[model samples]
Target: MKSISFPFLYLCTLTAASSVASGNHGLYDVRPFTISLSDGVPRMLERIRDTELPDAISQYPGNEAGISLETLKAFRNQWLVDFDWFKEEESLNRYHHFTAKIENLDVHFIHEKSNEPDAIPLILYHGWPGSFLEFIPLIKKLTQKAKTSTGKHVSFDVIVPSLPGFAFSSAPGANWTVDDSARVFNTLMTKVLGYKAYAVHGTDWGTGVAWGQFDGFNTSARAAHFAMLPFLPLTPEQLEAQNITLNAPLEQFEEQRYVDWSATGSGYFIEEGSKPNDIGLVLYDNPMGQLVWIGEKYIEWSDPKAGTSPSVLTHNEILRIISLYYLTKSILTSGYIYFQNPLGQTGFRYNYTRARTDAPMLFSAFKYNVHYWPRALAETVGNLVLYRNHDFGGHFPGLDNPPALIEDIREIGSYWE
Candidate 1:
């Protein structure tokens, strides 16, 4: 793979109160950055256009077997002809993009402050096969004042940070864990950005970071919300021992879905956790390979009804995310999180006592999520003030169903104070 570098110039200055001088251990000056990929876009496009694809094999219709050959061909055609990276770049630059040195890493984030008087600070964390790009649409909505369930108007000073080693954020060392990420982010909010208290929302691996914040910085992380939880839930026998009645039908459905996913859809998990370097090196220079590696999850793990009716997770949306991963060349480091904390192995262990947090928590469970636990089981994990279930969304709720996610976040905000 050819070497790629981002030609970014610090364009704007921030208040002294919000940043420290350069060379300090704390947040070095928060400087605005622009995304530039001109150096490698031509080669990336050529690769996409010239790539060879095998004949379409249809043992079963649609994506039942895997990401269909038809899907790959369509995406390739769109990338070569219709997709415009510059236009996407312009759209992203509409918001404020900045990076501050935290823990010796250039932590990239989109920090949009609300003008509303009652606006609160909120930090969003994105997980693997995802980046800060996932929350672009949601960030705009969140920064605007909206009425909550209690009729109180609220807006947010939204902070969307690229997880270390995921987009613009500097990659961490081999031993770094989500707990380390939680500490740095907590410092980003409290020390660098100067927020006395803040709220948090997370999805995928971000869920683990949020859990760490909830467990460690309960005071400053005043309120918490999650679209996904990382801990394995208690077994049926364990729940029965606690006198918690299972919603039998729903449990049966979720169990079957889990079984099917474990059987077929979790190969990426195992590979990423066990041998990230192998797959990362293969996909690093291969744009189509990266597309298949990440795009397949966006298709299979999202609402099946997406791209119909309301039209979410469109071709452009998926392509933009893939492009970010390719252009940034962070695909290899992004998978390192899996190697550091392999779920269902040495990752987070479920302990009701340890999981409990004083901060109020809200959970929004989208039915199409790849993994699930009943509301009864989720409640025991934290101070779960609200657990809302949705029939129409998936792992990527921000794109699959923005309105529902927006509503849930606002509802959780009402519980913040």
Candidate 2:
């Protein structure tokens, strides 16, 4: 990977006033959003499955390059015969869905209010190849007041947004980066939701947005939790240079993952970041391409047995995610994120100064995730009030380990109370 110069743009701002803010134009209504796909899509998708997919599979039999033929076939059969988009839509509507105009785009989000006294208002952000759907499993748990082992009452009024250019949300401008995304999301929580201050939690690309809030709107973003640690870990040389001593065992377990991910797992990032349009255009009309592209992540990044037999996430769960991108015709725009913010071999290369804050922050380090760090390493990024290690979950913890994730979040909510 060649070093590409990043022309940094500073869009970071810090403001948390309670006064209602209208964009250049008046604020649009936060109206209910319905997840209805066009009627023709189901039949059309079925036709493609029955015809095009088999031919592609036959031609690329040893496509061990990506999702195996058997897995693709299973998804196709289930999508055609068993998967029910109507039922999934109904289940999605069980929560409050709404869209409001933010920065000249319709920003879609799930805003579930809790009646529990002093419930924390939190905005949970999801990363790429993930929708607001990732947080659905934990929604009901967080929205209702529950007692912790210590007998403390905790609940949250949760807001989960589809990142701009993904799923139901409108796409940002062609030049948008995570920083741009950060600003828009800050406006959403403070001005649209009418919350003076709130907590934030995120994983993957959502972590960038959460970091944005903490960096730009510290007054409004009171606390944060991250399933994906954003900043890179300190190298042994850096530790020695800074004369910092380690208190905990140097986690060679995490070090090995870094080596493996860098060597074999970075192709998608390069293609998406460098030439998003190249692949996005090719896959624009190819639903199978979209599924193969995104589905591969679910298979590789998630726990190996998660969607397999005794599936933690069933075939239906897998199909629902892919189906949304296909139905909405937004897969291209979502994939374009890589093009806008190109990551190099080292990792994310952003030009803005690292946003440091004293606000309480928590980090959940799951073993199977691509990146892991010790509590001491995580502390350098923020207030680092809590760091918990988990043995079983992988990158997609919302699905792989929702119960554990929810419990950790409930524990964090106690700080707000």
Candidate 3:
């Protein structure tokens, strides 16, 4: 009986060891596989044509107004038919794009090589509501300027990849967060592209990934640049002590707008992070729902002048982002990322003003969004090399106001030398 008992225990222990080993061994090279996107489109379109999102109300005084009839009209006329995917596709493909396998997912990215040899390589990361298209205009001018006398692109060789579940990149597995996303991007940069050291730039959620990369990637990502800095953990007392006034206006007009954004604009964030799948299902089922969700951001966040802001999305930009998702069918996976790193949502909740990046961070703060002014906030992040209060450009500056956006990239891009 004692001999039989000992054998049974030994077998149990062996089984446990085998299971742990199987799960833990993915640290080796992560080669991704390509998944095509033909079947998913019809399924998504059928839902769009047939479905109607329940008219949900905002949690405020003008609740009914926020869910306005005009918003619906914009969705029908602009997003449904006017937006042309082929136009944006042709434009986006003009840049040098390449795809590679990273951590069990096929990753698609735009790699714009600079004409200059000493060009400092840069990687751009965009948050939700935008894709690699976010960085297109800036990249074009950087490569075009022939900036240096030697035509040596000085500071960066730009590499912009779609976040997992965002575009061509694979969606998150059961366990992927800002940390995982950062690590994969770093891998894309250092392991696959072979850059020993490089600078990273990002906006919105991408900012968090960029910061995480600074800590995770051993070889590169030592330098990080992000626009929306997280200062969540800090208390009100600490903020005042640091001379950071949350409600004070930097401009003389004196009305604080960020507080308004926190009250209203941040609802999507809570929805996505708290109930990602619910909203994702809506986005997945109704193409109109996806447009309402994403299209509004482009309208509210982009520059109003070109009359091209999300307020009135042209058929071009809106379809491009939606097509990327539809062609990929990554909606649920994209939303699931919220839960994977709940901490990532609070990433800006900390009190630290700046994490101190290694490279020169160009912060072209949007003129309208008062969340954080470019000049004051730059001190909290990196080597505040260039601070431009963009007269034009809202959230999607590169796309909203391309020519001005291009000029800024050309001017500061030469600094890599």
Q: Point to the candidate with the largest TM-score.
A: 1
lDDT of 1 at 358: 79
* Residue pair clashes in candidate 2: 273-338
lDDT of 2 by residue, 1-417 (tens): 011122121001102211122232135545555677757476547655655545456655764566888888877777788878888878887676667778787788887777675878888988878888888898888988887656788888888988899888888887788777878888888777667888999898788788878877889888889997555544555555756554444355555566567678768878887787888788776667777888888777766668543235666887888878777777889977777765531125323233566678888876667766666666666777777887667777888788878888876665663
lDDT agreement with native, every candidate: 0.80, 0.72, 0.59
lDDT tens digits, residues 1-417, model 3?
001124354346435422111111123332221234545656655665666544543453232435344565555555445654445555654555545567777677777666556666678888777777778657755654345433644445777888888777767677677777888877777767677777777777677787777545635654555455544323344446768664434332112345556656778777877788888886775666666677766666555564553223344556666777665666666776556656425355544544444455566555554355435545665566665665555666556666655555544444553
**In lDDT terms, how accurate is model 2?**
0.72
Error of 2 at 382 (Å): 0.7
Residue 405 in candidate 1 has what lDDT? 89
Judged by lDDT, which candidate is best?
1
Considering only N, C-alpha and C atoms within 3 Å, which residue pairs clash in candidate 1?
none
Instruction: Write candidate 1's Cα lDDT for 1-417 as tens digits.
Output: 111123232322334222222223223556666777767799899889878987767575478777888999999999988999999988887777777788788888888877676678889999989999878878878878899888888888889999999989989987888988999999888887778888999899998898788778988898888997768655556667888775666555555555668779989888988899999999998999999999999988888888764436898889999999999999999999989986664354554444545778889878788777678777777888888888788888888888888889987667877
Worst ten-residue run, lDDT, model 1? Answer: 1-10
lDDT of 1 at 316: 85
